[model samples]
Target: MNLFRLDASILPGNSASAQLADAAEAEWTAAHPQGTVTRRHLGTDPLPADAWALATTASFTPEADRSPEQREALALATALAEELRSADTAILAVPLYNYGVSQHFKTWADLVIAGSDNPTEPLLKSTPTVLATTLGGGYGPGTPREGWDHSTPYLERLLGDIWQAELTVVKRELTLAATNPAMESLRPLAEDHHTQALTAAREAGRALAGI
Candidate 1:
């Protein structure tokens, strides 16, 4: 089996999202000891900001008139799309930043769409995918920040609806409780969220392996 993993945490060393992804990945590895993993860490090695723009422009330009930069961008975009198209399964560890998806991930997604053979077609049709996400504050119904999380819904639409993947999300909120004095009272709930997310991640991983 081939597994594709993507990490988007700016703080890789102390990332809550990565923690859950680790649990899921560990289970997948245990099941498929001989499987190959393709890894990409956007935080450490981000894609070029202009690549998507160049690629999109190239699509409209005739092949013979494409510039060197455009050609390179197109190649990078195609490679990114191929990663999803070729993967048997995938795991994405993305954290909410500023109440929405990070620019790094948005760029990646745009490039993938620009590079696809058919933009309307789902690249990961029926593929099993695990999405591990974390939030620093609580966004549940009674919280002040309720309905403020703009990240998870976008992820679901892009990966599940657009890519047509069978996606399972493992989410942990209130991650800042341990560090922020203002959120000290939420520590207990944060711990609980952490534990539940880990369990869900492992279960998602096991299901991916079985698929």
Candidate 2:
């Protein structure tokens, strides 16, 4: 079996999203002790900012006239697409930043599309996928920031709709409550969210492993 893992947390050491993702991945690894895992850390080694554009334009330019940079970018896009195509299962750890998906992740998603054999095709095609996401503030129903979360929706559309993965999302909100003085009153809720997310992550992982 093959598993693909992608992490986009800029603060790896102290990331709430990573914590949840770890819980999920642990279950998967435990189930598939001998499975091959492919890993990508966008936070630490981001794709070139211009690679997506280059690859996109390269498709329009004839192969013979394409520049070296364009060819390289296109190759990278193909590789990214293949990672999803070949994975038996996948875990994506993406955090809500500034109320939306991070720039690096957006770039990665775009490049994957640009590299796909058919841009509109579903690369994952029902592959099981676990998405662990965290938010510093609450954005659930009736909260002050209700509907403020732009990240999770986009992720769902990409992994579930666009890629057509069998998706499971484990979300932890109010992650900043313990540290942000203004959110002290919400600490209890934050802790509860954290615990719930971890539990959900583990369940999602086991399911992803088909156990």
For each candidate, the alpha-carbon lDDT, in order, equals: 0.93, 0.93
**CA shift at 209, candidate 2, in angstroms?**
1.1
Q: For each candidate, how many residue pairs have backbone atoms clashing (under 3 Å)?
A: 0, 0
lDDT of 2 by residue, 115-148 (tens): 9987778999989999999999999999999999
Model 1 C-alpha lDDT per residue in residues 25-110, reported as the tens digit of each score = 99999999999999999999999999999999999999999999999999999999999999999999999999999999999999
Q: Tell me the spans in candidate 1 whose CA falls farther than 4 Å from its real position.
A: none
Q: What residue pairs are clashing in model 2?
A: none
Q: What shift in Å separates residue 63 of candidate 2 from its native position after superposition? A: 0.2
